[model samples]
Target: MQKHALPETVGKNIKTKLMLSATPLRRLSQATATAALGLTMLTAIGTDPAKAVNLKTFNISGNFASTALDGSIGLPVNLANGSFNGAYTVDVDQLPASNSFVNLTSWNVNLVNENTVLGTLSNSLAGNTAYIQENKLAFSDAGLLTNENKNLYSLELDFDSNFTGTGITNDGKFLDNSDLGSVKSSGLTAVTFVKIEPVPEPQNLAGTAVIATIGLWLRRKQKG
Candidate 1:
């Protein structure tokens, strides 16, 4: 039996060498597959696409004194003597071009009258908070350019103050005060605006790419 096994092993070795010459392509194909897998693994580990862009901020103000003629107050005429005393702001993902305007979503009014019961009418943050987010009366548009070459967005708000009066008694509703009868108060005392931006869109990023050479270099090297 031992003598027979030795002769079979020798015959198998001889056949293996003959088969290599007949199908050298099999060995070449195996080597090529192994190399491709190695390259693919390296790329997956080293060429991850993850990055973030910077954030932007914008300064804005809301005008509580703009007249109804300018599409601000819903009232017929000026009711607050063009005296707007509210705070507001507007922000976009990026700076808008000229002629661009943002819709006014909603707002809260902290109407304050010095002669009210609490010395101040209502604090918007308090229980008497009166808000108007439903009406689409407020909006902002890119303002006229200034000497500093900066563009601003203007916000407008208007009010009515003719139903109450300071001379008779403290009715607590300064908005109804008749002293500023039929006059719409719309203007600003203090204002602020802020905006933030995220990464560019995929198409925009592709268009702005300055470097797409890493993969190209690798492919060229592999070909060589």
Candidate 2:
């Protein structure tokens, strides 16, 4: 599902320079490949809350330029073989409440490769929610855990807790086929980082609004 359109401005400056180059752009254009390389690292953080733990807001940077592939990696002849893979460091602080036994109340990741939209997927955690939460740890390598055999891509981490589960969440299908043409054709190896925030509960905001409104009414009555 297309949620928010990625900032077209995100790669505008770089793309312009590439257009001026004499080389004909092809699948996995150099410029776009680099961008995808960078975006992937940044996108990993959205996999969990632990990544942005302390800051009011923070972004985990992805270095697409460093890791993006050119049609060399295993991919279809018709598809840009610019497959990229890397590991991002995600801290426990970013995922605290859940790791501290809260488990994942809800989590989702939206992946778009080359301007193609990838649908969102998530795990309710089911009965294993508690174990998942408690097993969450701050200091761990958030993995770009992809399975070549299964063609699965996931952002994963080992919690410093003992729990066993085959799959927590998977986003491979989305990343592989999503409107990745923009990335591949642009010849830009790119990284796709996603910024995530806690979804605010309606009651929390509603309660504050009610209190403020009541206070205002009381003050007006006094003046009258």
Candidate 3:
């Protein structure tokens, strides 16, 4: 007995289904490769050194005794992962001056549960120089400044007697004598704290490398 032949439409339908299935697999592979390449690029970006520097600015505006002081202080820090672990710089600019000499001897940076002393900038001006001065203070131990609380920090300025003047004043008192008295500036009128966080280096270098390798493989597969 002769078997009936299959219909032509049946063969066409089977061929169409097989083609559709193959197309989906190819598309899925390509999509996976594209995603891997994107991940690799992100890893490379995370490990780049150029993006690891963070800059912040704090402004102090208020009266220091009878003189009004206002300026922007720059804080440039290097971060590893999410923590500070490198050299940092504090730049003071637009310092205020009055008829009497004003010397900034030291500054105290107060964070949560910790206080840091920044003392005697290398280029700090002293004596009876009645002029505005700018200073740059560099510290290598910025890791100590980090705190879990990211709130605004306070700055306290310490001034020696030389800040007033070196000569004897009308009251027959030597204004520049450190033993006589010292000045501390606080009670800021306007305090503005700014924090800038740059892109940090990858915390896990090995993981990043593995991710990059996988991404490269995916890209090659896509190209092939």
Give lDDT: candidate 1, residue 207. 62
Per-prediction TM-score? 0.20, 0.28, 0.24
In model 3, what is the error at residue 144, expressed in angstroms?
27
Model 1 lDDT, residue 138, Cα: 32
Error of 3 at 4 (Å): 16
Best by TM-score: 2
Greater lDDT among 2 and 3 belongs to 2
What global local distance difference test value does model 2 have?
Answer: 0.36
Local accuracy of candidate 3 as per-residue lDDT tens digits, 18-109: 99999999999999999999999989887656533223222221111221133322121100011111111222222323332333333222
Worst 10 residues of 1 by lDDT: 163-172
Name model 1 segments beyond 4 Å from true.
Answer: 1-97, 104-111, 115-224
Model 1 scores a C-alpha lDDT of 0.34
RMSD of 2: 30.9
Full-model lDDT, candidate 3: 0.32
